[model samples]
Target chain A: MKLLFSNEVKEHRFSLKCIPHDTDMQKIENIDVSVFPDNITGKDIDSHGNITIFGYTKELHDSFGFDVEGTASTGLKDFESAKELHMVGMYKYQTKITAPGESVLDFSKKHSLESCSSNEEKALLIMQNLNNEFEYRQGCTDMDTKAEEALKGGCGVCQDFAHIMLSLCRLESIPCRYVTGMMIGEGRSHAWVEAWDDNRWIGFDPTNGKVVNDEYIKISNGRDFRDCLVNQGIFTGNVTQSQTISVIVNEEQNLIHD
Target chain B: MISYMDICGKRDRVEDMEIYTGADVVNEQLARYGVKFGIYKNNEFKEQLFPFDMIPRVIDNKEFAYLEKGLKQRVKALNLFIADIYGEKKIIKDKIVPEEFIYAGSGYLPQCEGIVPSKGVYSHISGIDLVQSKDGTWYILEDNLRIPSGASYPMIVRGIERRSAPSLFTGKHIEDNRNYADMLRHTMDYVNCGGHTVILTPGRYNAAYFEHSYLAEKTGAHLVSGHELIVENDHLYFIDYSGRKERVGAVYRRISDEYLDPMSFNEESVIGIPHIFDIYRKGNVALINAPGNGVADDKGIYYFVPKMIKYYLGEEPILNNAPTYLPYYDEDMKYVLDNFDNLVLKDVAEAGGYGVVFGNKMSKEEKEKFIAMLKAEPRRFIAQEVIDFIDIDIMEKGQLLPRKADLRAFVLMAEEPMVWKSGLTRFSRNPDSFIVNSSQGGGFKDTWVLSQ
Candidate 1:
């Protein structure tokens, strides 16, 4: 990630949620993180268990950046006990960015989601329906776009797709969360949904109409897109600022086996 | 209950009468001290003097004892509720408070999960508002757990009144209210992380800036803003004017939680110290009242507070919450619709006397529209039977006028809950209005707890 300020800015404070942590399905190994200007950085875990790196730059600078590199081994693991899921209840309710509107409500009612038998089934059906409905197009929606607006627009990125799926799944009383991470083919970070069924969290990629497997590496998960922001910051510059972010994932097995 | 005059005797009553006649003199001293609250109207900021009424609201010793116990119990239960909401959530699992109420309220902060504050305290300072009805029954009006103000107003007023009328203090058996600063300091010290204590204020423009500065002066803690503070090495430091770094142990932050940390909360906040919450999460520093306490004081959650007391502490609530009905429940919805004209409806998302509307005061068309809104978003509104408050006498323009008033009692949490002996008695200056918020043109009085 890189941030370019049109004018020299001082007191640049930033927080990044780009580092992936060890989860039930992913084990992060050999992690390295570096923030530009060589300032001291602090690493802490947020309420959602995501690794957060935060720091302040007191010197004047026109540009700043940070780099994170890690290896994540992804596969299914033992399910956590139901008693330990302290934050699962939060995902059952809709957030501001995921709350259903007239369009989403109509879509859910047309599908008759209430008659669905199980949480997993309801979630899969919503994923399929969202994949078929939404166009995989950028610029149609931004970070502040709500699920209802994205659905009405008929096109959005992975974040909007994940939000719409979350809204629909929650409407059916299925506890679901939004996940931000990287996939093998995608050159950038992606967003998806994880629905808690029975006693385990089952990942679903509504944008691709597929279940999350070993190819998908999870970074952070929360109630909606708001919780999984990769990078956010504030500074004293009244000058225009721009940001560029990219993510690349490769398998160690392929390099070794070859 | 003995009246003030009866307790003071004839000789002392003559001296006390001089204080009542000298209200203007007391207010002058208050003005010189910059005791005023700021309010915004149409995007314009205005600072108005919070008029001081000389006649104090005297609570009998026995009545105050009951109130002290009830306030202590209520604050303790509330603290436990906040801890559970962010920790084990046993209250939600036990079905005492529904999951929807916890997550749907905007007060629920996802960034505060699984973290316990220093000393395991949430609401280190709680201001619980209560009013006495015409039947002489005290009902809890609201809970201001997060950054509750108005205590300093009464605290400052008492000192001026004593200097203005020395006889009222020497002859009368009223508990000295000047000990609020000591109680506040102890609460902060009990949760200190082994460094200097500071009071974090947003700026001079905040509504409670007077209180923030006054309490800091009294408690002898440095008052600093966001820019004067820095986070380094996973700890908070205050940069003094001499460019020396001072570690801050406990912060009685007067800013709202969302605006306290730009990195962890609202990123657009310019008046917040970045990474402060990260250090707080690591237990390097203590935030007074703690973040995420809003979840417990939300109006929608207020209906379940008495139940929380029963669930968490296994005790019956000593005080009563005013007869309130949530439209979220079907039975309550029916009752609200049937008796819509007799109840006062409040929006759960609003505060500071903004979103309250009496049903009988609305026009027919407006009532229909409001009822439709009430039906559409049932969880957004709460209907309550309006409690007829007993009129408290305020000497306005040299004549005693009857007006509605409420007491905001402060409770500071140390090893145990300490309820202050005096409270801020705010009365609506307008005779017909029930809202006594200082922002809405209300005057205040000192609440005297009888020492006998």
Candidate 2:
């Protein structure tokens, strides 16, 4: 990630959630993080268990950036059962962006979402119907886009697909959440859905219409896309600023089967 | 019971006293002190002087003592509730407060989970609002655990009042309210980790800017803005004009939680000190009225406070909650719909007298639309039986008119809970309106807790 300011800026505070932590399904190793305009860093673990590395740059700087590299051993194991049981109701309710509107509600009713016996089945039904309806496209929806809007627009990115899936599943009282992390073959980070079933969270990728597998590395999960932001910052400068972000994930040839 | 007749007799005596004639001087002094609250209308910010009424709200010694006990008990329970919500899931697991109310509520900040504040106190200063019905029954209206203002208004005005009308107190015995500053200072000191204490303000454009500065002055704590403070080496520091940094251990932040730290909360908050939450999480500094207090004070959660008092304290609530009904319950929804015209509906997500709607006042078509919306989203609203609270006389151009009023009592937590002897008594300027919010052009009066 890189940020360029039109003028010199000081007192820049930034938080990066790009670091992957150890979970039952994935083990992160050999993590190295470097930031420009060197400063003291503080590490904090949010309630969702995401690791946030934050720091302040007091010196004058027109440009700032950070790079994070790590290795992860990924799997499709259901590890969320160890989490507290009280969270099921929290994710069952809808948030601002995931709240079902008239169109989303009608779509849920049309899909007979309540007929599904378990939350996992409802999540799968939501993913199937949303995948059939939505076209994979970028620039049509932004971070602030709601599930209802994205559904009506008939096109969005992974975040939108995840939001729509969450909206539909939550309308049926299915406990679900939004997940953001890296994919083995994808250049950018990906968003997916995880539903609580059999006392464990099962991952589903609505964007690709597939269940999560060993290829995905989960970094953070929350009620919606707003909680999984990789990088956020604020600086004191009147000048215009622009940001550029890119992600690269690779698999070792020995680990990949031909 | 202090009836309306008793208040009228007291009013007759007040009319003969010198304090009644000194109202203009007191108001002028208040204006001179720049005691004003800012409000926004049509996207424009305007600061208006908070008008003061000479007639005070007098509570008998016994009545105030009862109120003090109840307020302290209520605040203690609220503090425990905040701690429990963030610390453990016992409350949710025990099914006392539903998980939906804890997590789904907008006030519930997930970032605050598992972090216990300094001294294990969450609401260091609680502003619990109450109103007295015609029968003299006090009902808990709402709780403002997050940065409750208006106490500074009455605290400052009382000094001017006593100075202007010294003769009024010669015969009558009223508890001196000047001790509020000391009480507030104690509350801050109790939670200080180990260094300088400061009051963090959003700036002069904020609504309660005057209160922020006044409290800082009265308490002798430096009033600093976000930019004046910085976080370094896992500690918060106050940078002076000379470029020297003083370690600040306690911050009575007047800004909301979302705006307290840009690194942890809203990234667009330019008025927030970055990494402050990081230091707070590290237990390096203390944040007064700890972040995520909204989880306890959300209007929806108000319905469960009496329940909380019972659950946490295992005692009967001394004060009553204003006969509320949560639309989320099917039975309450039926009750609300059956007696729709007698109930007052409030949107849980709104505050400052914005989302309140009187059932009888709504037109037929508006009522239908609202009912439909309410049916669609039951958890979004709460309905309450409209209590016909008694009114006090407010002098308008030499004529006395009765107006609806409420009291905001402050409870400061140190080693134990300390209830302020006086409170901010706000009265609706409109005869029919029950909302006494200063943001809606309501006027305030001093509350007199008689020493006798």
- Which candidate wins on DockQ? 1
**On residues B12-68, what C-alpha lDDT tens digit does candidate 1 reach at each position?**
333346556568889999999999999989999899999988877889989999999
Candidate 2 lDDT over residue span B211-304, tens digit each: 9999999999999999899888888899999999999999999999988887778877888888898889889999998999999998899999
In candidate 1, how many Å is residue B251 off? Answer: 0.7
| C-alpha lDDT of residue A137 in model 1 | 98
What lDDT score is found at residue B161 in candidate 1? Answer: 84
